[model samples]
Target: KIKRMKNLPMAALDSETVTVVKRKVKTKKKKVKTERKKRKSKENTSLKGKSEPKDKKIQVLQKNENNSENVESMKIGNGHDIEEKVNEGKRSKEFESGHDFEVELPNKKQKSSFRKGNDVEKSGEVSTGTVLKKKKKKKNKNAEQNSELENIAQKKIVGIKDKMNAKIIQATLNTKYKEEKLKTALKKSWSSNGYPLKIDTCDEDSGIKLMKRLPPLYYAPIFFNFYNLIDSPSKRISMFYFIYLFQFKQTTDLKNASTPSLSALRNFLYGPFRKYLMNITGIELDNTVDMGSSLYEQTDVLLCHDDELEGRRIAYILYLVPPWDEKDGGTLDVFHTDKNGQPADIAKSFFPVWNSFAFFEVSPVSFHQVSEVLAKKKRLSINGWYHGSPVNRPPKFVELPRPVKSPCHIEQEDLYSWINHVYLDPWTQKEIKTKFQKDSQIELEQFLAEDKYEALLEAIKLKDLKWHYEGPANKRHYEVTKANKAGELVRECLKFLRSEAVFLIFSQLTGLRLHKLAPPDSEDEEEKSSEKEPSPCVSQEIRRVSHGSYTLVHDDDPVGSQYALDAMLFLGVSEKWTQALGGFTSYIARDEDEELLTVLPRSNSLSMVYRDKETLKFTKHVNTSVKDLLEEEQQFYEVNCTYYE
Candidate 1:
């Protein structure tokens, strides 16, 4: 989920909305004069004073156009002026239309089926519509039942009033009142057919198995949050919030976990709620609910991960929010499935509603993320995992495609062509190697051939071409062109990177014995089925790093990982790109707080570096200060390849 405006529309995070970490009440859009119809929800889970909050409008000012050369050149506008303007728009919209925000759900067919406690076995793949009809019973809303339920609740409350602890929470959950109320909410949730479970599979073409998916998620409702008997502290519960507020300035930071305070919320989740989950889903959850609640605010985001932790079976989130506009950010954006049946770009975004309870089975294709919150509001939720069940059929592991062997030596003809495209001469190459030997990193500007670079720049502007929104927003936010669909220039770039000339050049420049270069594509079935031969290198696709595009820090390289030489060739960049506006890479020594090197993604610059055991690197997120004069202005078109020595 997005911490603030950073996650919503990365392109929109200029100088407009302000983000403050706190709890959110729902957004009220309309009021009616119709006679009050008594509500049934109160009878079961009565919080008489805890009624749903109407919309509380916080006026946000749209950022003024400031493509001024410097990142700090943005001029701040008056808050009062912006607030008044927002009010004017709101009033007029209310007069003209019944709604304040536009509600747009994507048009997609949903197939979901779940039966009640009795019909579990037959319900696995049945139609939800047919089963829900049988589940909902017409119970009259009368004072007699309400009073009886309230009386039972008072007795249970008085009986367990002593020693406000975890046992009490577990006992209360077993009580008929809590069980009945939660059961009703769960049944309604399954019956409502609110979540979409489509056959979103992976694209078999790519080796990054993560991009493929087969997901059918459950978006649990609001009442799910209060299922626990413990009274969660008013101060909340989001550790994701403080990370951005405190550590936004640091470039190497990754995710922030929960701070221990809200024992009530944690106990409720791990205790009785766990039992209720078993009753509904028919899966035995693990003993402990790893109580790590995530809070994503402005720029805070959880990138793409499969959540394949040991002992974890299902991943769950209970949002502590009132309803609000979907555009407010804090959405659970499920990735679209690639040809591999793995998760790909973001296909759908589920915004945080105060009472939302959403969960999904942790599997290979279960790659999901939080989009940037474009608005100034807080997206708060409690997240945990239920472990100890048989891993929902793990997808077959797919290794990155085998290396495409190129010649070990560079021919003179290839050298000349490379020289024409890139401005590196023998002397400059010598200088680069010398600097690399000392620092294990070097940046060479004008690295791409002039004509080739110019042609590719034009090719990227083609509107007919489809660019995948590379996601799991916590890890990265950008787009990538499918090289197969893209025409000549993209093809040529791929070839050039994999060419014997460039490989030998890089090998010599870095003093590494690299032989083969790997492309980011899957191997043939024969190759996949056969015994794997030892390879000399590993690499990935040519990526288009655009606005809000980022790579967070993590201990990614395995002990025996084949990544010896890493290269990032920057292209398609505008002159307006500045350090203050991000789009830079940060290299840090794992043992210290110091950032070892900062590499800017300047146009036509290639930064090739050696990875030491104690070092890690990441591309800083691109900010919204750039003019975006052209569509490509937001992009860092580059070939990130690797070599095994």
Candidate 2:
């Protein structure tokens, strides 16, 4: 019976299908009729209180309502078109909910209905429910994706806004701290003192407290190994000058790292702090700034200098050292200028104090130096220059007149008494002349008589000799002892070097015309007139060199620019004197940094050189080791003389 039912033809089951359809239609009709009667009775009650509609309008409304019912009933009776009936029922529901027209469904909903309609015969009710659910799910997914994209865009905008706000705040803070924020006390002190005021940065009004809080800065060792001919123990080293045992490190711009604190500090110094400096110093400065951190350990030193450079208005040093005293030997010594622009003496000395600041206008008279670091503590600080208008410098200082000498007669017996016997030999003189001509220099060891050398070494210990301290500090620093102030033996030695007999000997040794009476081939009146112009003369000094003594090559010195023959006889030199102890004489080319010759101190030795106008010379700064000899009352002496041709 089951197989017969499954195999039944479409027409054979038509009667049963029709009966079921009729029953469902009858149930729907009853519900619809009941709802319609309620709506009609409500309408009649509402109209009872108002005028009746026109007869033509009433007839048209009734006709439309009847037609809608008839079409729904026809759709329900067709079992094969049951999907159409469901659609019409949905339309009726929309009208009941107060819609006046047939509502348009989404394309997706219409497509799903079409697909489900084709499957209705096989799956019936399940397909219809599934299509509606899928349509709703697709609509919700689209909404969710759109919402997420908007959120992402909003977040990006917020991130950009936050970055901009941070930048604005930083700019405001920088602008808030201006030149007006500086303390009045600082400006008043600067005005009163004129220069070199010691500032205590620990005070809140100092306006540089941020520098103290920054992390430790880095430093590199700044030791320049060569003995400088011009400037020594300088904070800066040039092609020719070196800083001997300087033992300090410096940054060129204080930009060693990129840490946040370091960057902030750099910005503060280059920006707001620069304005404060301009206000306090009352100097117009540009935006250019040169800043650096420095570290000075034990034995470090900075020699005397005027801090003069182009466009540098103010020089400043901020001390970040530990507890210090004058005994510690890092005191800042400010020199007083003589009537000339030369540095004369320390007008004032300031010891390094923790968190103290010092500043001065950079000018010709602003000579200063950092004393050697004696204690084991580190001397840390920040030092730099504020650049602006060029300094209106004073005229270059004219040095005191140097003594001049003409060749004078001296007996051969007087020369033999002091000079070594070997130097007097004609054969040795010929050999020296040959070598000096080839190299322009020569050093004669044991050039003095053995007995005379010993006597002069002993006589140099005499305390009665009047010693004149020689300095402008920037050009030369040493002690000069005149021949009249020296003992009998020392006086005789000084006289012999300047005598005509020694001048003739020097001419023979160096092949120079130092002792020549007339020019070579002087037969013409022009040559005779040249002789009357000026005779080749000699300048001599008995120099006593010890610690803190040096000579730099300067353009203002006329003698260094001339062609001359030089002779130096070193006496009373320590046996332990080495090149490292400094005090050596160096000769270099004027236009270049080439070293021509270097003569270290050797007791009883004579150094002679003939140089052209293109060469210059300087004495190496005697290092602190020379101070040790002072305790034993020992001194290093030189009979230094220059013979011009």
Candidate 3:
């Protein structure tokens, strides 16, 4: 007889726990079926031929059938514990196939077998595959949750970065009044009908109509009465002056500043502002920042330049100055280029207005400069270039052929009449030659005859002389005497400096070969004479130096571009002249910022310097103080002569 199990109630479990228990029950049922097949096969073998044992075999078969029916009943029961089925199935399989496998219990009235089996399973009898399957499911759920969290974190990071960039842009610009106006200004095509329209924010009915007829040049300026919340990056800048050579004070290395406000402003301009410009101009701009804070004190100036470096797309300035006007002399001046691409006349001048922004496209014709600052208040501004893909540049401009040199063939008495007698002495000549050879330069004080120097000084101040102004203002700005337009004494002084006698004398003094013959001190004179004689050539100019006069190192000046022996005869300089009033010539190595030498002006002194191709020279701009020190003319003269062999 088979035992009947009592139905038992159980606490509800989660779906996953219940599923694990049910799968274990199904595996036990499969094992029970295999046990029954083995028992039946053995019963069939035992009953093969013995008739006397047939009745007993039949009874054993009936008992096996009853056990199978009891197992099926256990599987069908709702409250049967899965642990009981697993343990019962194992016990049934453990018995030998020929042994009787019968349950000893009363039907429907015995201790519950499932409860006993639950106690057994609780003593650590769970299968390894069931534990591993539960662990794997939990791990998969954790992995999915971690991926979702990472995606959320990544999105937050990107959003924060974008917000920070926007904040920086808004802080640097006074967008309340300027943003919409700027957007409106950029809407129009930069150039139209062969002319560029002006972008002026001060007035609505500005020069747009008039500009249609003007030459093609792009210019924009934004003026506002209000200031931004961010401090001006240029206000606290330290300055180093170039003196009168270039004459300005500017901050060096304007990147990665320690100051918080300066760093923030730099980020704004170099990042968001650059992207805004790229969008407006439709050009690919670079990420690098090039900028500096500048301070222009009184008399400081920046001469004309196009800002046309490789990859430079646009030039910009943000004026952080006080109220200003044209009289202040620190205006941003734009120039028109002539047919030869040289800066010509000033096309427009924009005075520094407090909190104004200005910019222009950089090109071969975009010549501009900062005029000399005349006000005592400092002119403060932040200026820089926005770099982009480099545009196709025309070949470098080659200046017109230099004026032909005149042959040296004047009388010897003419030289004697002007040159100091001390310079004529052989012993004195040897001393100058020795010094010149050592330094490649010399200054001869009282270089002319006493009487001749006195006459020339007085003649230079004559009002009858016709002065021709020289410019494009980029390279030089001064006066040159018109042909036959100076006094007779002044003309004679110029002629004396260009004479052949002076050339040979200069050769003996400086030990340079200026004629067919070698210097008097040369050892192999016969050998030098046999060689091809260098053609002796000379060119001279008489320049009038006054307030604002200057000569810059430009490609157009032969002295700046080639090797030459330069002799400068200074006249009419007052005894009270000081270096502070400028008008000194400075020599520096090519492509270098360091000043190598400075030649200060003194009346009747001659400055001779042999400059190689690697050297460049410029006369500094004379300030208004020249008027107080000199006579009413407020000017002096320089007889500049260059010798070529």
Highest-lDDT candidate: 3
Model 2, which residues run further than 4 Å from truth?
1-182, 191-249, 253-262, 517-534, 591-594, 627-630
Cα lDDT computed for each candidate against the true fold:
0.51, 0.59, 0.63
- C-alpha displacement of 138 in model 2, angstroms? 49
TM-score of every prediction relative to native:
0.53, 0.62, 0.68
What does candidate 1's lDDT look like per residue over 540-635, in tens digits? 466777656776554433421334566777777778777755667777766455677887777777788777667766776664444344765656
Candidate ranking (TM-score, best to worst): 3, 2, 1
Q: Write the per-residue lDDT of candidate 2 for residues 540-634, one digit (tens) a residue.
A: 88888887777877777877666788888898787877776678988887766667789888888888888878888888777666655656534
lDDT of 3 at 135: 17
- Per model, state how many residue pairs clash: 45, 0, 0
Candidate 3, residues 169-283: lDDT per residue as tens digits?
Answer: 3334444323555455553434422344244234353322112212333334343222122454554566544533467777775786534345566777888778776665566
Pitting candidate 2 against candidate 3, the one with the higher lDDT is: 3
Residue 331 of model 2, lDDT score: 82
lDDT: worst 10-residue window of model 1: 91-100
Most accurate candidate by TM-score:
3
